[model samples]
Target chain A: MLLLQSALVQSALVQAALGALPAARPTWNLALPGQLLGALGPDLLLAGGAVLLLLVAVARPESDRHQRAVGWASLGLVGLTIVAVVAYASRGALATEGPIAVDTFRWAVDIVVLIGTGCTIALSMESNPLDGILTAESHVLVLFSAAGMLLLAAARDLILVFLGIELMSVAVYILSGLDRRSERSAEAALKYFLLGAFSTGFLLYGIALVYGATGSTNLATIGEHVARYSLMYNPMLVAGVALLLIGFSFKVAAVPFHMWAPDVYEGAPTPITAFMAAAVKVAAFAAFLRIWLDAFPTVAYQWHNAIWLLAVLTMLVGNVVALRQRNLKRMLAYSSIAHAGYLLVTVVVANSLGASAFLFYLVAYTLATMGAFAVVIALGEPGERNQEIADYAGLWTVEPWLAAAMAVFMMALLGFPIAGGMGFFAKWYVIDAAIHAPHPQTVLAVILVLASVISCGYYLGVVLTMFMKPRPANAPAVRPVPTGTFLVIYLSAFTLLLFGVLPNGFVQLAHDSVPISMVGAPARAPVASAASR
Target chain B: MYPLFYSFCFYLFGLIAIASALAFVTRRSPVAAALWLVNVLFCLAALYVMLDAPFIAAVQVLVYAGAIMVVFLFVVMLLNLGLPGELADARGLLAKILAGLAGIVLLAKIMSSRTAVPIESLMLRPDSLATVARIQGAVAPVAQPLFTEYLIAFEVTSILLLVAAVGAVLIGRRRAAAVEGVGAG
Candidate 1:
């Protein structure tokens, strides 16, 4: 009887030890609003600026001076936000424990977006009422859109990605139609809204399917599930990924889904066009890269072929269609589509070097595209005339400096001689990345080179018209470049050239900004579980 | 004891939903069509309730039938569309045939997929009376995840609504300006 009692006592002790195992499970701590604000500093700043601009508009109704003040204030806010992002990056604080991530990648993308927005504001500073009625609301819309871009770049959750896309898209749709007097602007707005809403449906459906398949919407949790389960062949996951690819393809204006680009790009205000082309592309591509690299890295082989086909088709269709375009804005729109193809190739490579190349190419492309559009803005009168290639005839003689800026932009866009501009280096880096990828994509690299050569047909067409073609008798004389536009053109051109000649420093920055540990890798497990929760 | 009654209610709601949806699409007048849509929504809500999701059923009635139907009525009344004949289908016969074919194909695909995946196996819990009692309360399970894991999404939805409101005002103000300018001229 004594022995049996002792055995029971030992059994109780073993049961107590086994019950303590679950105490090791990590418990999540809720982030405070103050901490969230610190992590999302740039987004909050831009949002606050937007609200302030709206209040300013309401208080001082329609005064042009007040509007200009609002514009400058918006510019200052964007500039300050860039500084904040850089500061946040320098602090090396990883506050990405919540839905948003404030890592080096986010900071670099934020800087790109903010700089593009600032340049756009400068380009729009001398707003012609006839071209588009620039209200304080325009600047406010831009600020809100920039906030959305920041959120998108930093989004670590699928829900945040959807919200960020919506916020950015809605603001842009309104901005696209801000020129109330232009029927084309209204049409652009309507078409973009309809198609954009359709694409958002696909995106939401994809998110729903992904959540259903993985039982989680948190990207890290999804990645963990994928890694643990080897869910590559799940039909629901495959469908979700396809829908997501389609949705992003529409946003980036990849061919077969790019029906809205040329019209929307041409009909929107010139500065807004530049802003959309640069900032929107950057934001969308950033989200695309993050989502594919983080959540779906385990299934890379499954989706890589689809992306490959998209890249090829986008490059071919964009350049070929652009060759037939006579309007300069439409041509640039097609060129932008072609560039999207190149960017998509880098995404397919899906390596740290590819990420760095993507960033570098984005910088080069943003500068060149914005600079080119600045020239367009400078030449355009109140009614948005002088958009034809013929309109740019003998531009070299009329405005030598503006013509020279346009030439530099064209050469950069063409990816000419290695010494010609940054675009060449950007292309080279992307090709190098493709070559060095785990599964080298030599075919894609060849297609990229061939497509670049084809693109020269249109980009050089603009250059040739500017320098060689004589002024048509009916062509309007070039308007004197505004100081704001002149500043934008020279700054972007100078940066383009400097980065081209000495790309090492910027290349290092790009390399350092790559979120290598975040992509594909599981997040760190929580250290200490809540004691006896 | 409950199986026969449950299937009866399920089929009743499902048939009503399908029939009302067809009627909603085929109606001549916008107001009549909207009323039919409300009926369809109510039927779907009933179906949801029968499927052990009372919260979703309530939302379906409140959001789809009440709120959305009101908006539809408002728009139809605002436009005062002239006649059913004027709004009749204008597509070619070939297009109509193609659309019908596509619809049939989609229906077949859905049916096949549904058959391939047995609904009994898809259930998270055994379909017993006790399990039903345990699982029927839908709000708490959904509310927990929505408030915790998806709190950011919920907040962002509010922002999206705000953006939509602002965009509407901007576009509406522009239209008003254009109309005023035309009136003055």
Candidate 2:
């Protein structure tokens, strides 16, 4: 009789617990959302492809042939992803709000990141064997990192953003140290890992503090709360925003936080360096814009001064320091920092026009930078030797085509009008956006022009060195450029020139790619204007 | 009345945890510091048990307080570190002052925030969590959220972990091979 009573009480407890569980949770539901594919198709495809490639890598031992095959396969996968992104982008954004984005902006970033990934794979395929890195796993790491980048482009919530950052960072960290024989590569990896982890800590703490202040991590929801409550000056929110700005500064390699870029870029393999400078920068900037525009529009005023200061410091420091770098790789690293400053100008605008301008500038920047890195690989010998600025002193004498192509890349980076081609229009639109902002950043526009002039000291220095200086008496013979790398360089230069002459269509596409939800977020206007975001 | 006892135990354990953490930092010997860390972890586990999360408490004791602490002790012994005076510590006056200032400021902020921003309305309200915990047992409280609304993040975390593990193995093996080659030569 006592045993039966105990059993009855246990059953009663179980039923009571089950009954209260539903009432205790008022807002949350366990049912899956209605739609998923239109937003997440490309990311899922990329992840699937990467996992399969990783398995393939596990099956094969490290070999030059295996590496090449993996490289080609990675490029093909990136191509398919680009096709999916373009198709879905035309279909418009998903109607429902979720953790991941599926807008034209996200798709545009996807295409740009994939372009960089494809080129990096081609370049690495040519250079890896020469460097004696036979691991097919390196290609798999690149694919994994690219998938992470795609996720970053689509992240709509803070937690997703953190995961995306980690996924991208872990893969890139290994890729940087793939040439393990070199002590410099190991040092680069360790420094990058330690410092990157530290920055991630700052990012997480900021997210936590923001969550504490407003009780939401969803960007759209946070924006609504901030607008409705007027939490702009709330001390906690301000501190969270400040920390977030600092964290992103580290990620994007802005001045005062870019101590790692030069050493790591120089020590890393050239292909990985290009990936860092192009795709990594693009992804970080895209996420930065997304978070700032979508989540913190009410408190956006808090960051304008801070961003303006960073932009000025980054531009001045990056260009002035680049003039002193003799190593081509380090110089390009610092140049990327300067470009980061230019990108920050667009963030300052924080309007539809600015995002549109950012898309165009980023595309042009990627093309020019990738073409330049390809040329760097073509000219560099094995073991990363002979990459000094003077090494290409008389490239026009032995290899006129390579020298001319190099000049085109340099001029484009310098933003020279006709010579720079697409680069000129890219810079013009950024300045146009800055000046036409609700409150004009006229001083910033002028500073940008001055920084470009300062950058000419190095960009033109490369061009003049190639055209005017004589080749050394015992210079090494020019290498035969790989067909894949040659194609990358040719396409980039051709597109830059072609678009420089006629930029109407590209401009329209850039304009169209601006996030529709962010269209009303001009300066001094509350982003609450975009309903149903 | 039972809930009051739970809060009393929480405060007691929290105080012990804080004191031990301070001692852990200040301890001269590495082993002593690690032992203090174990003490703190135990207090945390006991506090977890008071909340009726015996599974979490057991796991915390097993994984962190026991296993990870043993590793720490092993590393401390293996390194054979020197005297306490030689061990790295915050020696500079400026650093000391700055650290103290930061701590004081943080304390001030928390104290001031007590009235202005109570903890209840903030992101991690304990009331709702307690009810959920009663229904879900020890791990379910965490796993419920992880597998449900944040399912994608949870799945992607596995990919991140796999990538990290593979990278470590690949890098470690290459290093070992190079060292072996050197030894053979």
Top TM-score prediction, candidate number: 2
Q: Candidate 1: interface RMSD in Å?
A: 1.0
TM-score of chain A of each: 0.90, 0.91
Cα deviation of A507, candidate 2, in Å: 0.7
**What lDDT would each prediction earn against the true structure?**
0.80, 0.84
* Model 1 lDDT on a 0 to 1 scale: 0.80
Q: For residues B1-185, could you state the per-residue lDDT of candidate 1 as single tens digits?
A: 39999999988988988898888767777778789899999999998887766777899999999988886787677568535754566545788689889989999999889858567866666764336545656656667768876776776677667667877887888788789889999
Candidate 1 local lDDT, A1-533, one digit each (tens):
76445444543432232212232333222377566657777777777767777777667765567778888888888888877776666665555356777566788788888889898887776753446485667787788888889889989889899999999999999888888778888888878887898899889999999998898877777887988998888999889888999999999999899999999999888888898899999999999998887788898778889999999999899999999999888899999999999999988998777887888889999999999999988887777788888889888887888888898898898888553478888888888788878899999999999999999898888889999999788787777777778888998887787667655556656665665345334321111111111
Q: lDDT of model 1 at residue A121? A: 82
User: What is the lDDT for A417 in model 2?
Assistant: 90
DockQ of each: 0.60, 0.60
| Per-candidate chain B TM | 0.63, 0.56
Best by DockQ: 1
